[model samples]
Target: MAEINASDVMKLRKMSGQGMMDCKKALAETNGDLDEAMTLLRKKGLATMAKRADRSASEGKVTVKSSGKDTVLTSLCCETDFVAKNDDFKEVADKVADAALQAAPGSKLAEQEIEGKKVSELITELVSKTGEKTEIGDWAKMSEEENTVVGSYVHFNNKMGALVKIVCENPSEKLQKLADEVCMHIAAVKPMALNKESFDQEVIEKEREIAKEQMKDKPAQIIEKIVEGKINKMISENCLVNQKFVKNEEMTVEEAVKDAGGSKIAAFERVAIG
Candidate 1:
């Protein structure tokens, strides 16, 4: 077997993005062969992921990467905030986002590869280093086309964000600005759905049931009106288009979208982790 020097281990660390000890061990196993060490590291990642399969990974960052007229939102979730904040974890997440962006729209992000390694393999490597569960979470991709505007926002903490695409007769800087503002609004408001039509029907019925119970003492006619009023108010608050505009309280997001180029919010997705 060849000698494994400190420099060779460091080189493997850079190449595999695994921890120092892992790099050293891989080098030893590979007889100081850099390429073989990298392969060993990736294979180890799979075992590590399987070992920690039951761990709950609830924390991480949402990455919104944009290139030209396209944008991809991807999240890397880990077992704790400490691991989520780790520099290596963040770098891997960014790489995943980049790979997702490069792949065809709607591609399964975990299947995408860097060099010869699948993204899922890369994540398992980090799981081994951190001793924490790590996996990809919510993701979305958007490609802008004629007569449309795209906007996206990732909160300062990077734990939550939104991406929005709007349709207009003629896209412009002004409309784009509104779309950006709406993305921020989405981050702040965290709407449940684009509109009431899309809101979960069972949830809607449940709300109506709750309202009926609350007003059960009133006359049937009065109770009926009160229940409907409460349901409408609840829908308005939860639906994205019906929710009050976060920037200007005077209008609903629907009105705001209309005011900016007589447009409609064509598509949106909000991604978050806790």
Candidate 2:
């Protein structure tokens, strides 16, 4: 058996970010071979991740990155808020977001490679280091077309994010600013759909049915009026364009866009890690 020295164990710890005892054990198992010990550590990490597959990773950071016309958002989840706030975890999330932007939108990020290692492997390494379950929760990308502008916003805690694309006949700095404000509104209000037309018909019908149930005792004509009023109110609350703007609550989001110029929201996406 080869002798494992303190120096060798510390070196492996530095290289692998594993605990001192874990590094020492790996080195001892590998007969003091640093390269072999590193591989052993990675294999152990993979095994640990597999064992933790059933654990829920609800706490995480939402990272957003944009270049010119393209924007991407990614949610990197872990088991605890302490790990979520770690600098290394945040850096990993940023790198993952950047890589996701280059790949196809909605690509399986866990299968994609970054710096020669699959992202899932990197996450497994993280789980090993932090002693917590880790995974990628969501991935989304948006791109601007001709005469369109893209904007994004990440919340203060980095747990929520939004992306917005606006189409205009003539795009300008003001219009872009308005689009950014719209993204902020999205992060705050979290509207379900862009407008009444975009809302799912089934969802509308469900809401109508619920309202009818609530007003079952009323006269038929009165119930009809009440149901219509309730449905319209729901649209104003849940539809992005109909919802009141955050900057100026007096006006709806659609009115805000029209007032800023003639631009309209082409698409918007919101992501959150809770």
Candidate 3:
């Protein structure tokens, strides 16, 4: 048996982007042979993925699979965007998103299967074939029965993606237009929540403190009103539904959703490639 030194382990880690324990184990399994260790790690990833494969993937391609009110929008990531567009990569993405649709209600990634292979094993297979790392980044599953309608926005460069799930009544042309506008808004504004109530209490408190400091020198009688006004403004500015529409300033997102056709946004998703 050959001695596997620290440098050899580091080299393997750099080449594989695998965990330290995994790299060391691979080295021992291969009798300190670097090439053999790499191969071992690859095989190990496939086997391990088979058991706990439904992990949240952080990199890959963003794909949309929809049929009327039932839809699935997912982002599958690879070590590089180059591989993300590969035919094989796209095929895997389609399969996963399709699986997500066919998967049991409320089934998560770990529970879904793609073409007889576990989700994780499929990802490892792609990694092995493309010579790059791959994983699922994010996903949105919508159903009318669940009161969720999907609106997707794919970045012009195809490097990033986003999905917005709207819960509105009797979606009309205007509502569809509004949904599309909201998708654009998500691309631009990037709000943290839908409204003030959805904001973290600590975050709200922090902003309140900041506003209070800005009005500290004001008359005490007016300070309370000032703080209240600032808090409202801050919440409106940060919440997606409260902010004025980017395309039409006359209406806020909340109003737009309603006036567009008596509908309201239910949920949303977004993605970007590094």
Candidate 4:
């Protein structure tokens, strides 16, 4: 066995966030090679994480990042609220979200490599530190198209977030600011879809069926009218543009967007950790 120095062990501990004993063991196992020791420690973390695969990670954090043209949101989950509040856990979530902003639009976050390390490997390192299951819960990326702007928000608790992409004949800083406010509304109001057209047809059919059941005692002619009213009400409540604005409840989100400068919602995505 190669002689392991205290300095090398401490450096490895700092690099891997592993305990001093584990770092020393890794260093001795790798023959005092720092790079090799790091690799070995990460492999150990990966193994530990696999053993914790069945554990529930119900508490987590949400992070958001944007590059003007692209916005990304990611949720990193852990087994407890204490881990979720740890500085290390928060740092890893921010790194994951930043990497997501730069990743290929359709790429999977866990599979993507950042600076030669797989994203899942990073999460595994965190799992080793916390001694609990940790993983990426959800990820979303929204890109700004021609004549469009992207905005994002992460809630104060860091447990909910949103991204919005808007299209306009005239995109300006004011419109971008509106996009941000809309993102907050999204996080709070939890709209199901952008509009009636973007909503799922299957869900709409189910809603119609539900309405029919609720009014079975009514005449058939009145039932259609009642169903129409119910469907319209559903659109007003569940659709993003049609829903009442969270900032000012008197106006719909659609009206808010238009009042901001005739911008339309191109896309929106929300992420939450429970």
Q: Per-candidate RMSD vs. true structure? A: 2.5, 2.1, 8.8, 2.2
Cα shift from native, residue 24, model 3 (Å): 27
Residue 264, candidate 3: how far off, in angstroms? 2.6
| Residue-by-residue lDDT tens digits, candidate 1, 1-274 | 8898999988888887777888888888889989998878777777778887898778898999999888988889988888888998988899998888888866787899986878887787777678787888888888899988889899998888889999889988888888989999998888988887788889889999999998999998799899999988888888899888998989998899889884788889888886
Per-model TM values vs. the true structure: 0.87, 0.91, 0.67, 0.89
lDDT of 3 by residue, 118-233 (tens): 77666675565565656666676666555345666666655566566677656556666667678778867878787777877898789889988998999989998988898788
Tens digit of lDDT per residue, candidate 2, span 41-124?
888777877888898888999988887778998899988899999877887798788779778976788888888888877777
Error of 1 at 70 (Å): 1.5
Candidate 2: the clashing residue pairs are none
Candidate 4 per-residue lDDT, tens place, 133-194, comes to 88888789988788887888889988898989888998888888888999999999899899
Model 4 steric clash pairs: none
Question: Worst ten-residue run, lDDT, model 1?
Answer: 39-48
Highest TM-score among the candidates is held by which one? Answer: 2
- Residue 265 error, candidate 2, Å: 0.3
| Candidate 2 residue spans exceeding 4 A from truth | 5-11
Q: Which residue ranges in model 1 land beyond 4 Å of their true spot?
A: 1-11, 29-36, 103-107
Give the C-alpha lDDT of model 3: 0.72
Error at 81, model 4, angstroms:
2.0
